[model samples]
Target: MLITVGDDTATFDAFDQSSQVHTTIPCDTSEPGQVLLPHRTLHDVVAKLPDKPITITHMGSAAQFTCGPRTFELPPMTLDDYPPLPDMPPAVGTIDWSDLAAAIREVGAAAGRDDTLPMLTGIKVDSHDGALTLAATDRFRLAHTTLPWDGDDLDMLIPARDILTLARTTWHGDVTIHHDQRRLGFTLGDTRTILRLIDADFPKWRPLIPKDSDTTIRIDRKTMADAVKFTSVLAGDTGQVVLSITSGQVTIASKTAQDGAGEEVIACDTVGNELNIAFTSRYLLDALAGDGTALMTFTQPGRPAMVWPDLPCEEGKVPDADRGHLLMPVRLPG
Candidate 1:
């Protein structure tokens, strides 16, 4: 394979390259044939490259690349070089990096932003009968989404952080995921990453989401998010924020020893019973930050509530996807 650049070119011939001169590094090909370069070396090389066209060929564990002025052969990188990453399934459904990554990032933030729960480090991907479900949970909160796929049958869980990393590094294209019980593998164009799944069983979370609600309110998502954030200063470690909805107004209030107390009110349309609810200020903020439309739906006080972007399917409209925050309420100050 030969790749050309502005003024320099690198070429590799699988048929003619002498086996004796080309050093072959042993790698874990048990999962699948893949290659990874030294993380530091890979980063430095890409950073120094000009904005010229680059060509890469996927030849199992060995890959050939040509960047401007520099032509070098990179041997396969073994998993041992870096910390272990969870292996993703070998085949992913129809791959649209943009959509897939957006979904991943949406869920990843819920798990990544808080390190309090180690299990949240992984994303539970369950594939059964052509449907794929991706879920993440941090004990106190959970985010999940479903997508249809056209591949194999199986259920697997992989590290959420590693999948997020893959999402960030990949551009719009198809990615190949290879999996067996022992490990999960991923191939995106010429890049490949393998990760080791955490052996712990992901909690049975489907039942936790509320299926019905007595109270549903629609409020401006951004406006409400800002209100909660503004009041969280007073919601410190006591981390308590109260949501009181009556008639047509929603009030968010909080109090902390150092920050004293604060409150913000926003307009909303409420239905069913009038109620007051309280939640951890930080948890509410994370749910609001999720990508969605302007309006968020509050189901009921102390019940699972969902948030949605105001206008979906519009330019910059947060996709109309299923995402919500469920917080067990805290006792209010008497």
Candidate 2:
């Protein structure tokens, strides 16, 4: 990267060759020429300097950084050796980066990390009639959510780790998106990111979600999550947690041959039958990692259960297809 020192100001041009990003900083410069420094090298050296203001001097063959009594001198690399950054495709639409990021985080939590099933390792981005849906599954559980999009209809399966980088990142400004058959891009303020879409096909997940509930547990989201986290401590190597439900209360419990047993009971506003349901502690923890009242539904022993942020559900009402997680229960050894 080139740092062009001028009379009035200095510019740190990272995306200059690609013309995608540019940032400026105020500096008092006596070195009016270009200093070609390795980006990582300069960043590491300067990060260790004292908090005082730093003064940089561009020598004939090297550059020196001075702060207080500390001094760091480094030679500049040849500017012609740096390769050009690949430019992103034209933007197809724009979205609030924060909003889009949050939706991804909610849905992408269930994506599988095991590499054997390549299909489940991605988050499917499906757009239709200006609405977008994101879905992911790890065989044992599934998560999906929706967002409104003002873009063309398309289906793209992107790697969860790469796509989630956008969600986990802290940035500002609306995100301008660019996509084609194989690539996806996001431009937020001066930052631009490009990722290759996964070639694998995401499984058909819609039909896996159970419609009817024989048992439902409704409670404060934080209350349930905290109880599960605390009770699961005795789960030991299996990481299994059980929920024993009654009419107005539920108990969280865990036990193993090597670890002692533990349980906690909490009152709740719930309806339906009383039963015990077993689930992976981590799965329940992940599902409850959000706000709002927690609503979980079950069909019977050994069937898949569903967790949701409690919304209105009337008789014969079909749950929102795009806004909940479907989790398969674990079978304790007989």
Candidate 3:
């Protein structure tokens, strides 16, 4: 890591084996020399410091940190050995940082945690019908969403951890995106993030989604979510809840050999065959996470169930298309 101080601005550069970050912040410097410091340790110490401004004095091999009467010196590592980060590609487009962050958070719900399958560990960003869509699956459930993007088409796999860290930031405004054949860069104001694009092919997942359905139902999101929470108390270790549909209502029931049974019936608008379907209790809660009425479509009793939020999302950002979450059912003998 290297820190170069100018008359009014200080440039901080840090890089690991694969990723890099650069930030330029306004500061007052007299000598305007370079200081080498440990990025991780400096981050930890600065995060614990008070909000007041701190002073840093560059020494021969160590930097002195001073705030009021508190002071310390940290010996920095050699900056000459640090490899230069790859250059950021040309600016292709920009996206609303908040919207992109939200989409990544939502679609990441279905990303697999198994590190052995590197391709399944993050969201896949690609163009669908000339629109940007994000999709992720953990084998049991899948989350798909589309967001507003205006630029040349891009297809890349980004690690969930890296992007989520960006999403968690409080920064507001559009993020300038840079991409080429080898590296991807996200720049906002004086800060920038560069990461190597994961070099693995995402699985072919379109066919796993059903083209037709045997049943479809529209119901209040809160109604089903609350019921699942209530009935899952007796669902035991399996945490399975059954949706038994009749004419105009659905019975949500859960039972276990040790514990008794719990049941709750809710009214829903059913447009197809009345069938009994079972899903993991947590999966139902995740699918029904937001407001707005949810539209659930099914193929059969034991197959996958698709959940869609059939209402207007954030204004102007969402397109007029079906964004669905496909959930695989939990199989058990009845």
Task: List the candidates' TM-scores in order.
Answer: 0.68, 0.84, 0.87
Considering every candidate listed, which one attains the maximal TM-score?
A: 3
lDDT of 2 by residue, 233-322 (tens): 889988889888898999999888788988999998767778888999999888888777877888787999888777776433335545
lDDT by residue (178-263, candidate 3, tens digit) is: 98866778899999988776788888877777766677777999999999999999999899999988778889999888888999
Better of 1 and 2 by lDDT: 2
Where in model 3 is the C-alpha error above 4 Å? 67-73, 258-261, 311-320
Top candidate by lDDT: 3
Worst 10 residues of 1 by lDDT: 14-23
Could you tell me the TM-score of candidate 2?
0.84
Ranking by TM-score: 3, 2, 1
Candidate 3 residue-wise lDDT at 244: 89
For model 2, the stretches where C-alpha displacement exceeds 4 angstroms are 1-81, 315-318
Q: In candidate 3, how many clashes are counted?
A: 0
Which 10-residue span in candidate 3 carries the lowest summed lDDT?
Answer: 312-321
Q: Taking the tens digit of each residue's C-alpha lDDT, what string does model 1 give over 283-308?
A: 67766774433444445555555554
Ranking by lDDT: 3, 2, 1
Clashes of each: 23, 0, 0
Q: Report RMSD (Å) for each prediction in the order shown.
A: 9.6, 3.6, 4.1
Candidate 1 global CA lDDT score: 0.60
